[model samples]
Target: MSIADRVRVHSVETLSDNHYTLRRATFDFRRNDGRWQRQVRESFDRGDAAAILLFDPDRRTVVLVRQFRFPAFSNGHDALLLEVPAGMLDAAAPAARIRTEVEEETGFRVSGVEPVFQAFSSPGAVTERVHCFVGRYRPADRHGPGGGHAAEGEDIEVLEPSIEDALAMLRDGGIRDSKTIMLLQHAALHLFPGAVATPGK
Candidate 1:
């Protein structure tokens, strides 16, 4: 039987609809042993987002952004989180949205974006599938000093670090954001192979 046939949703209650929708779902699932089990779970429908790692192959550097994340700070992570340029789709195409986001957050206007993959950042609690991509940029592509929209309260700091240094940041826990880590790893393996030695086996 398909997954739709294997489970049934009893109800979904909207707990909150402020910034994003938060809902509690109650459902029944058919177990592997033929028993039916009922479960309740809460998930945040924060909308899907797209992210891109802007890289300059010639400069061997990648563009990143640093911004304060309230959730992280509330959880005791007091540092401005470093991440790839990303934003909510808001009905826009993933590719188009990310291209705009990169330009807005990093000041780089990237044209050709190579999609890497899509994945649920937190499937158990958040219904947000992040569309990831890697795009090439050049120093000439920077047209503005991107600090994000002040009206939206996005005070972003842009960073351009070498691919090697980014990998080291990944290893040393400086780059804790999941999307950034994934794209950097993709760069390490595919885009800039042999740029840096892999960790000890």
Candidate 2:
């Protein structure tokens, strides 16, 4: 039987609903050997998000952002994180949202974003599926000093580092954010083409 035929959802209980929604789910599943099992799981429903890596191929440089992340600090990580420009979809299309976010977060307006992939950030506990992209940019694209919106309490620092240096940061533990790392690695593989070696050998 297909997965849909083998599983059933019982009920969902909302635990919170402030910035995002949290819910506990109850379900029943059929085992491969024909036994049925029941299960309950809790998940966060912050909605999907989009992220983009902006690169200047002519100059071999990339644009990134640094912002204070309270969650990271609470979890024993350095609060300031360097990452690609990103934001929650909040009902906007992934490509459209990322284009706006790139400008709002990095001061760089980018066009012609190429979609890379979509991934779940924390599948076991969070229902956030991130849409990823890579886009081309140039120095002329800077139209403002983008530090995010003051109304949203965003104080961001834009960073432009050479592509090589970014890869080095990935290797040396300077860049620790997951989406940032994924996008940079994509740039190294497709944009730079054979510049980065595989991790083990």
Candidate 3:
């Protein structure tokens, strides 16, 4: 049976609506044995986001950002995370939002961004899908010092790491953010083309 035929939504209760949203949902799942099971789940609804990996083919480098994440800190991980330039969609198209985010977070105006794929960051409890892209950039494209928006409480530090170093970081767990790791590995596989082995191969 299709997913729609296998599940039913009973109700959703809004738990919060500050910056994002939180909801508690009641639903019914049809089991493999044709039995119905009622379930209650809480989900965080932070809208969708877009992320981009900015690479310079000639230089073999990628631009990234570092910033403090309160959630990670609260969960016993390093608060400062190194990740691809990303931001919420906030009513903007995925491609358009990524362009603005790249410039705002990394000081690079990139064109001809190639869409990769969309993936859910946390399918279990968070309702956020990240639209991913890869784009070519050059040093001349840097137009501003990107430190993120002060009014929005962003103190992002822009970073340009060589492709080799980035791959090493991924192998050594230095780069722990999932989206960033995916983008970097994608660059290694497709953008760089045979420069590195596929992970686990």
Candidate 4:
């Protein structure tokens, strides 16, 4: 049976809603064994987001950014994390949102973006789906010094690393952002074939 057919929501309680949103929901779930059980789950919803992997095919490089994330820092990652340009949609379409994010976070205003896929970063507790894409740019495409919005307290530093080095960072535990990892892997497989090899090959 489908999830909607097998479950019923009892009540939803707001746990927190100041910054993002956190809610506790109680529901009745029917198991495959034909038993119904009461369950309580908390969900964190911060809205959907969009991320783009900006690449320079001729240069074989990818544009990235380094920024401080409180969650990552609280989880023992104290240093700034490296990741592709990404931002919350906040009502904009995925492709349009990502295009703005790429320029805002990397200073490279890409003319177009080829969408790849969309995925949830953490499904168990977070209700967030990220739209992903791959866009191309050259040195001349950079029009501004991107450091994110000062009003939002975003302090971002741009980085340009070769595709080989980026994948290597994926192997070496340097790149930890989930969206960034997914985008880079997609590029390796489709954008630039043979960019990544089979493990232990």
lDDT of 1 by residue, 65-173 (tens): 9999999899988899999999999999999999898888878887899889998999999999999999888899999999899899899999998899888888888
What local lDDT score does residue 60 receive in model 4, on the 0 to 100 scale? 85
Runs of candidate 3 exceeding 4 Å displacement: 197-201
lDDT of 3 by residue, 46-76 (tens): 9999999999999988998999988888888
Local error of candidate 4 at residue 110 (angstroms): 1.5
lDDT of 2 by residue, 1-201 (tens): 358988899999999999899999999999989998999999999999999999888898889998989898889886588899999998999999998998898888878999999989989999999999999998888998999998998999999888888888789777888999999988998999766633432
Q: What's each prediction's clash count?
A: 0, 0, 0, 0
For each candidate, give its TM-score against the true structure: 0.95, 0.94, 0.93, 0.93
- Candidate whose TM-score is highest: 1
TM-score of 4: 0.93
Stretches of candidate 2 above 4 Å error? 196-201
